[model samples]
Target: MIEPQPTRRRPAADVQHAVERMRELARALPARDGIAVFNRVYLTVTEEVVRRSADGLFRDPLASAELSARFAERYLSAVEVAAGGHRPPACWRPLFQLRRHPGVRPLQFALAGINAHIGHDLALSVVDTCTARGCEPAEVEGDFERVGQVLTALEERIREDLMPGPDLLDIADPLTHLLGAWSLERARDAAWAAARVLWRLRDLPEVYGEFIEGVDSSVGMVGRCLLTPLG
Candidate 1:
């Protein structure tokens, strides 16, 4: 009798497939739609993660892959929850709620989603990854920081690519200032801090859950502000 082989999870490969699926979906949607804009940004980030993972650039490839997958899962789950007619986290509520509003520009939509994901989802995802692997955040902090760097670099590109023409860079463009107020670096730092706090409170499930919920809702409020339409 042949021995049964243990199953392995290819986290990077899974992200690649998910990115491709999202890319196709974005292509099928109207370009100006808010969700499509964020989808494009997210797809680009996933592609970069997959590429870097393939090059063995991470300090711990397995942990990196797991962390990335867990991070992406949070975003995807929010989508499913909203699609099922249930509200997602407060951070996510803004994007899903205003995703189709004519007054909200694509740039606002993209940035709002980035704000929510980085501020709330990333921290929880860190906790989830640590729980799954029975390890400490310090063990995977390198991967987390590297991923943050990638997102920060990509965020610059997003601003340049999506911002209105040079003539509109003045105060007349409320979107410019609104997006500028949120920084990926700040969000990343806060996320790490939140992760540590959550981990410390983990033994108290009720407290841990409430902390996570508070983070989620507070981040959502910021997202709502970011997505506020400028007419």
Candidate 2:
């Protein structure tokens, strides 16, 4: 008998294909499913990236797409792992763990998902792009920043769509404070810092492993806090 080859997510390697996968999730999952909420948010972001790329907005659209595609694969992989009955990476665990809790607001789910993806997946994605493109992280810094700008732009919209109005939630609310404590701009800066460090330590397997593990755990902790029930 012939041995079978292992399966791979061919879509994860392409921006358009990745968007399709996200769409698949959006269609299949419940509208209120925590994962579904995040999936919808991510889908909108990815679509915006594609639109901007097509509009000739990015300085290096190819590199931007490549980086975005790689960045998406990490989250998509985690979803696949969860679907396969295995725990995802530590960075993604908290979101999956508390996804359906009644007391956890949609905003919490959205932000927690963003926290996990931006905090951990993003740094590794930068490294992934560098490796695949035969370039340093600095070479792709422009693409990184431009893509991040898109997220930052959409973030306000995400809040408007998901966050309860002042009549519902207030500054005194723990959720508001939690949201205030985390900033996408800050997360982008930290992820860039981690990526530079990751690239430099790539030659040192042991040290790189430890550093990545630390990042994963630390980000996961923040994600868990973000997902905490408001009640």
Candidate 3:
């Protein structure tokens, strides 16, 4: 007969104290440092949302709606930075390229595919929000057109500079194949779809807030995970 192993005791107090320390660190972070924190949070939250959504978190229509709304908020946040008016944190470039890493590439491609599929849904959400609030379609479309141009340029630059070269051509080929399999023409399709949704949902402040909060929370979590680990 084998001796029984001791069960691990829970350390709730230690966990709570650790959390408090993390919060303090987050609070003390400078704005530049905060960007990396937020980006990490965004990535974590989005990945969780994607996983959960696929695992039937969206079985409830309301939860599904909330997830979609959150996605829109996160995408818009990134788009805002890409629009040239605001500079996104430097970490964004590397974080975005993390998708290309061998360990994380599959998930990155999945996100790219999802982005392509849901881009219109996001755009429509925005459009709907604006219209309900008395904004004209033309105005929303104009803003989207301008923003879309900037985003396109940014994506192109990323592909050229960060995406792997011919040595990694095999990986690129498979990715391209996967994109075709998914019937996605490009990642830009997702951006376009999001703009369409925004036009449609521009006036639903409550929905918008839910979306924004999800993103904010996600960002917070990511920051804590990435930065606190360093500390």
Candidate 4:
């Protein structure tokens, strides 16, 4: 049975809380578990955001913290939904469905998770942050951009570290072809565009519902493609 979500949406407690949540999740999952792979990637980025915020990196630390926490909450919430034996959103189903498939590489799991999060969760998170802060999406754009920069930088490191060497996966491998098809920059750009669209549709609840359904299914489709295994 699916557990009901809270009626009122709230900002996650804070960025450190998000860090702790991901940490606990990582500890619970097996070392090479696909979800764990993605969890570690996200946790590292959250920890960095905490470090940079302490160093006074963001223009508005408090708002940035809230934004980051809110973003993490979406992923965490999806985890909870699945943990309770209910289906997660369409955007999240591919990773959960394929997490244990031995044929799929860790890098594939990690990227598929990112595809779902960045492609779907991100735009919703922007709207989530704006609503929680009682501001418009435009007002919240700075923090969003800063968080994106943090994610973009960490993603490069993740790719370098997680990618198999050419000896293991040759240039002609299907994995190589799959990797070439997706771009983090393009996903981020599309997310920003979706965020603005969602913001505009906020008043029309039915329209917003239909629009996000498309985003969820489309992102999930890409995630499925990312998880396809090859020899």
The global Cα lDDT (0 to 1) of model 1 is 0.85
Candidate 1 lDDT over 84-140, as tens digits, reads 999888889999989899888778888898888889988888898899889999999
What local lDDT does model 3 show for residue 163? 37
TM-score of 3: 0.34
Measured against the true structure, the TM-scores of the candidates, in listed sequence, are 0.92, 0.92, 0.34, 0.91
- What ranges in model 2 sit over 4 Å off? 1-13, 166-168
Task: Provide the global lDDT of candidate 4 against the true structure.
Answer: 0.86
Model 1 lowest lDDT segment of ten: 164-173
Better of 1 and 4 by TM-score: 1
**TM-score for model 2?**
0.92
Best by TM-score: 2
User: Of 3 and 4, which scores higher on lDDT?
Assistant: 4
Q: Order of candidates by lDDT, top first?
A: 2, 4, 1, 3
Higher-scoring candidate on TM-score, 1 or 2 = 2
Q: Superposing all C-alpha atoms, what RMSD in Å does each candidate have to the true structure?
A: 3.0, 3.1, 19.0, 4.3
Which lDDT tens digits does candidate 2 get at residues 1-231?
999987744332488788889999999988878899999999999999888888887887777888888888889999999999999989899889888888999999998899899999999999988897799888888878888888889988888899766455666788778878999999999999999999999999999999999999999999988988886
Indicate whether candidate 1 or candidate 4 has the larger lDDT.
Answer: 4
lDDT against true structure, model 2: 0.88
What does candidate 4's lDDT look like per residue over 131-162, in tens digits?
87788888767767777788888877888788
